[model samples]
Target: MPVGAQLLEGGRIRFRLWAPLAERVEVSLEEPGGTVHLPMEAREAGWYELSTDRARVGDLYRYRIDGVGEFPDPASRYNPLGVHGPSQLLDPGQFVWNDRNWRGRPWEEAVLYELHVGAFTPQGTFAAVRGRLDYLRELGVTAIQLLPVAAFAGAHNWGYDGVLPFAPAASYGHPDELKDLIQTAHHKGLMVLLDLACHYFGPEGNYLHLYAPAFFATDATGLAGRSIDAANPVVREFIIHNALYWLAEFHFDGLRLNAALLQEQAGQPDLLEALAHAVREGPGRERHCHLLLGHDRRAARYIHWHDHSVPRRYEAVWNDTAQQAVQEVLIGAGVAAVDRPLERLGACLSRGITAGGPDSLLPSAFVTFLQDHACIGNRALGERLHQLVSPRPLGAMVATTLLAPMPPALFMGEEFAATQPFLYFCDFNPDLIKKIAINRRKSFAHLPGFRTPKARARIPDPTHPATFARCQLDWNSVNHSPHADWLDFYRRLLAVRHRQITTRLAGMHEEAVQFTLPGEHGLSIRWTLGDDSVLTLLGNYGDLPLAGLQRPEGVVLWAEPGEAEHALNQGQLPPWSVVWLLRAAG
Candidate 1:
């Protein structure tokens, strides 16, 4: 049954809930003087509903289970106070929308920029992000993928700890303000992809256990207390409806499902498949709704298992293998360690996979990035790419990612080389705060630096307010010398990608792309499009210039460290540098 407080005609609000455990459910509306309890009629399939004209928009309400304690609506659209407070009635159709004619871009053209609403700006609201839409548009990103904005317990969090899936986080802004951001982004030719975590619910303010125990399955090993029961029909419907609500109501272009592999159910309809089907058959089908699954290499094969005869199952999956391999080569044994850097990096560039390729999947099905939120935030020490590697190597890695064949995503501050660290932070209560801090320290106990008691004490507490404040991007830093130069470098690289590379790779056979190691520490990649045009990339990872390498005959599009003229004149590529060349004819 459809859940939550649905507004009908003539200022009437229909409150419906699925409470199988309760004999009677009543709607408690907060009035001017006190609270008013309205009796609800029980329906089939363990559902209860009530219609009242007095409960209009802006009214605060909750559910009384079997005349017991009151709790916030599980399907709340707005929580004015916080996740634990009363649910406010909101009419989705009331807000004026301007993105009617905005159809999203193709998957191949996507250059994703991931950000958290709180850390994105000092203001930490959806309204604040609207001021930077033009900046992102000028930066040449086609899409902005935001972390979860659902209502949670306290004032600050990474958004993964959301308890109310339907309600936008009150700390971010008003519900209408979120719509304003999405509409504004669409007008600027930027698509919005909301990050959603449906595998498990957060511990704080989680009211599901109070009403619906069947919603979750017992899994002691799961990250959260328990995993969602994907096999349950009610749970499945709730998940599917939430996906549609975001697309149909908020006008978001797509969704990036976090920990997609965890939602798998055996001998039952897959949640991802049902989601893709719902989007394709729904009213937003014309918008080309892209579904990107965040899965590791172990689940890459499942992405291709869906029938190709149907509409495309997913646009792409986050290429963690490629990210880890590249990070190994650049950072080596720094903050986070990686072994076999050369071999892993070589395999990633050669076959589009670090370990092995799923034969049926297309090259575009994988999304690669030089740095991502998890790679920087979840580390033992939260460090940016600039802190991990020198300028030249960082430049080479950034260039390689942008010019790669697969879609590429960028963390918020990477383009300008912002020095702020993106550490993992949450705003749980004091009781859970100490436990979370201890567990976080234990997570990195294997590392030599974090193994000591004194060293472990230096680690930032996830519940500290200062920790969340430190992650905010410093927009002023872009005005400095190297930061300004790096920003320009990203602009040029993305320009070349959007203009020259993306169109050329369309329909090209896999055999046309080739990768070769120029030296023990350098790589060379060349590919020919169907139009006979050739694109080649050369990089030097060592401290010395790579010599005696065959150079492709074409115009030099870009070079690292402003050394294009020097490298093109002399056949030797400089140390820790990369160059992109294009030939009109093979």
Candidate 2:
């Protein structure tokens, strides 16, 4: 180990570089006043290290090899220009926090809002996003899920192609700026969950493969795997260390692990257990507050069907199966099993993945959605939930309120019905850009009745005002007639969740949650607290009117035409609408 390794755990600035190709190495720090240089001592394995008493937390520094100019730290705290530019210094402890009273509400109470930082606001920087924290708080959202911020190839990207796992994208402001955002969110009572992509594949400005072959795993195609395999001790240590670094350095409340199907590999002796153990028992890990949120696709089998295992303990999976199930029924897909199970949708609200059955005829946990960032701008489906469900509010009500067991997530514009599309665009190396274009062309070519690539290239230029305009939340829409009415509908839906459902099920375990989705047009769900209190949530999924329904409880949390009507009438439901009923206290 180099002398710099001695201070790895301390706040003192220390530096190390694996530049086997270089004859000499020097560490340089750029202060607000001037630049300073520190001598590096060589160690075994072509590594160089240095420890300097002058360095502190906010020092902006990089390393120079031989006579070369300074390059950003491979593990930089901030890269304002994505991964292509210089690094910036950030002090994590400088910001004052306000989430002291927050003990992270359980998973049952979580309503997630997933947003891409680059597209979430008119200005993509962390400081710019502080304005919207209050809106999320008011919407009954318990967690705000941000896409990755790791340093990627260029000035703009999705952050999935990130290379520097430790660096915050410079486009999103410096590290301290992020701290301010988190602190601000916490003050407003919103927990922040950052999405982290471990399946690392990026083309430019990344020299990790050149520096260490041991860092990536080889697949059947011999392609380099993105995530660290727990089978490899050193690699596992690297990932665990990275996880710990973010928790301590950034004060993030939780991490949404990307693509759990890839991470939760079989015959791995439960890698997550090892990871949880490392974080729970590792030195100083306890000092920081954090949660490991696994974004898995296999929520049904692991979370409910089977007993507790390494993978089952994850906070939650993405629940795509549930999403799909709801969508299929709403879209009127006549796949025998689903069409026959009129109560299956209702069962979905209670039993979750099981609504699709153990060997689901269709995908359970469809992670169903009317419109998401992925389907945006593809000309494939457009961004309207009504377009997907038809007859408007009927399908909307079933999804928004009646779904059980599974927690639902929404994109930024879904609430008030913003019309802009979230396209998939990125700034990559020139060669990689060519590859992206070709691959996209090939993908569109396979789609029926599609010939031109114009629709595929619809992503707005990130630097343009149009891009920001496309991403901004349409707050004004909330007052615009039908859109405004729809916005109010979402509010009522949320109120139902809080005052009726979430309050009762907050502490209930997985088995206690149950659902029943009946036919293609309606769902009924049952939830019970302890052994005494119980309530049933029912919704009509079709157009026209569903009437003659009895209230399962003494009180109704939400209903069509107002709670005064007690019984749900289809005339009151409108098309694609939802409603909830709660039992009143005697």
Candidate 3:
């Protein structure tokens, strides 16, 4: 076996994998010429390691355990031919990264825009999506949170059911194109975070279990063929290595770990911690990056940091509680009471966890959002915004953006009132599609008008234009009245956030930040920066008029124009409206 240049530098590549059931394991390499096998030495705690004499970039490889079957490398490079194909060798040092000076924005500063690549544009390729970067930038987004773009079964999927963790989806363009997209984003000053699924493999072309038993737990609600469980050191290494590979090779700013709650194991020093440590310490090895956990539980939790800091190791978690709160207000669900249950939403934005205390949630801080791909997906790509705001589109915009303390995330086309539904569709997985449809029906069977069984059926043809069309952002919608108005409101809100909040917190101060609202009718807040400047934010969430909001001595920085906008200033919110004011910067 030829080790090629891999061992020439004298840097030892340690191999560790957890395969408890395997009697023996050997690494297999397939070059353009032929196939080769290298025997592995067993290490303690269910790990197999081998040093190859001839493995280098571009060589396709997998593992053969006890001569049973060929398996893709757990730390694979390219699922290039899709999930069922061989793993291609890739060198982490190849790509030239452009984000040298990028330290990444603080969690408080992030304005995330989540996008599904297939539905984001008509082309459904990484290269094609590059055209929209300027538009996102103009909307004041600091980061782009992409839905999974990993290789899955068939021609299309939402990317969540991706079976191959290493390969960027072939339909979405090749690995180099993905690298180019990241490079473009960095040059345009946008951080790119890939949504990674490490829990369950989607029902298309998944072969993890075929290669090895216990690769996915047989138990219900188990890892679902997508975990390198923490208890297994080799599995842990595989996952951590993949994460490190992305950060080091592609210059990705961070990864949004999907379904973080599922990979549960005790005291084995799991992949999550190892990945974080590697990224933070990668200046000598490669580069530094960030990691954000996407947890399903809305409850909050405390994150211990190396030093006591506002922003710690795990940058920020996703706050689904905020989504529920906004949903309540948007649907006009008993929102009048100021003392109503707000801790779930509040705690989500402030801390990562939902539970704070005895009848409360956790304390971990997180990123907040009003709507997302999942929320839209659950609604069968229906008109959720229209359902909420209806004639009061601007009102909905104000409430969603202004109320969120953690950086707010907006789904693509949400700003322009793109009426196209973000439907849940997957490539030709008949069995999985059937299950999905059935699951949707059972999940929403209790809803009043969801009585039609046919409406619950999954669209069998994922590659059909209709599947992608339903999720497409209707750029033409902007000219229409309500949609245009909504877009304008969002732009104004972004301006307010950047002009006021961004400047005030150029330096961190827990004491300086304050949330103030007088009564349940309206909110009047004054943020004093000691000597720099003061920012006053006023908003009204009710239908009636409000008055007697005392404003301190400062010139009005900016306000929404016209009657309805001014009405918001008086604390009389016209059913979900807000006005932001900034004191003149000295």
Candidate number achieving the greatest lDDT relative to the actual structure: 1
Tens digit of per-residue lDDT, candidate 2, span 133-231: 887788767778888888777666667778787887777887777888887887777778788765564566665454444555643211122543446
Whole-model Cα lDDT of every candidate shown, in order: 0.81, 0.57, 0.61
RMSD of each predicted structure: 2.6, 5.4, 4.8
Backbone N/Cα/C clashes per model: 0, 59, 30
Q: If both were scored by TM-score, which would come out higher, candidate 2 or candidate 3?
A: 3
Candidate 2's TM-score: 0.80
lDDT value, residue 279 of candidate 2: 56
Which has the higher TM-score value, candidate number 1 or candidate number 2?
Answer: 1
Q: What is the lDDT of residue 18 in candidate 2?
A: 63
Instruction: Work out the TM-score per prediction.
Output: 0.94, 0.80, 0.82
lDDT of 3 at 409: 79
TM-score of 1: 0.94
Model 1 alpha-carbon miss at residue 307, Å: 13
| Ranking according to TM-score, highest score first | 1, 3, 2
lDDT of 3 by residue, 214-280 (tens): 6564533322335434455445555666666667667777787755533445544545656666667
TM for candidate 3 is 0.82
- The candidate that wins on TM-score is 1
Rank the models by lDDT, top first: 1, 3, 2
